[model samples]
Target: MAQRILVIGRSPGVILDAAERLRGKGFRADATNQFDDVLTDYDTATVDVVVFGGMVPPDSKRQLRDEISKVNGHVTFVQGLAGIAGLIVAQVESVTSAAGDDTGVEYDAAERTVRLTLRQPAQVVVEAWWATSFTPPEPASTSTRVVDSRFDPGEHVVPLPAEVPAVASFVTVSVGPAVHTFTVGAMPDAVRRMASTSALPPVRAVATHTYG
Candidate 1:
């Protein structure tokens, strides 16, 4: 049976677009913006995941989350960080595949290396950014490095694709939908390191608000 995904948001177009794309990915998908309708639907059918768009107010998100938790503890809730359809889809994929805790990650500021351990063959995303309270990553582009699609099951070494300024920052590795974050001290002279002479497109994953 296909996984049932419910997309809830204020925009009908965005919700429907994501729902349609999810169905194309071989999942049972539905979309709606009504808050009460979500409660009614949850009561009637088994929904594996619920994705909340940006338009939904925080109070409503909290209420819906609480109501669903009372009935079924397994239903997953994901917050749509932005209007990006792919990000929302990635959240669902990551949440569902988080069954095994069999992964390891290491980041070295001096070496400019991000080594990751995977249990299976999968596309990987390695990134580093200068995350500061004054300069939020979401609104600004303070990223020091970004790389994508270079990994196998066994442990592999990859470089942070960009140079970091002389400030403490964070590094992240994303395998499939699962993402791991690490802290690094200021390194003003860190230069970009490439895993290969060839270049590939990058895949990115951000922190998501998740609920049971």
Candidate 2:
């Protein structure tokens, strides 16, 4: 069966455009301009994913999310869309394929590298920022790095700044449109012990969140 996708937008024309584009890409697609109608249709239709168009208000999207969660938790939610048709299709594909895999930052205490793993191939980019405060101090130094090349499905580790203070408290990993955060706590010491080991450190499972 074709994947069922629901697109909600403020403009009826734009919603219809995206729905048609998705349908051309082989998805069973539908579009709507009203949030209330979406909830009404949910009971009558089986949806695999719901994407909020760029014009949809953030608050309305949140409301739709809450209401949808009550109806079906397995359905994936995506947003932060661009008007470009190809990019929108790619975004949907990436999010849908990323299910059931690790998609976050893992610290390698010994090598001082942050390993990011994704379930599918993508041009992955990551940002590792650190500071003494759990909230991270203002003007905290943030280092952004991109993988030297597109990563195939699996793990890729990028080295962090050697100057990173032991007091570093947080790290955020971004893979395509998905982002995941981790609290530092005792990661520094853990990395040190890992560095001393002759065996490779086991890949740690990390949870990821999507933002629009």
Model 2 lowest lDDT segment of ten: 203-212
- TM-score of every candidate: 0.56, 0.45
Scored by lDDT, the top model is 1
Candidate 2 residue-wise lDDT, 99-191, digit = tens:
444565577766667787667786665444443321111112233343436778887778766555555334445565554544443334533
lDDT score, candidate 2 = 0.55
Clashing pairs in 2: 109-191, 110-191, 110-195
| TM-score of candidate 2 versus the correct structure, residues matched by position | 0.45
RMSD of each: 11.9, 15.3
Please report, in order, the local distance difference test score of every candidate based on alpha carbons: 0.61, 0.55
Q: After superposition, how far is residue 37 of candidate 1 from its true place, in Å?
A: 2.8
Best by TM-score: 1
Model 1, position 199: C-alpha lDDT score:
41
Least accurate 10 contiguous residues by lDDT in model 1: 203-212
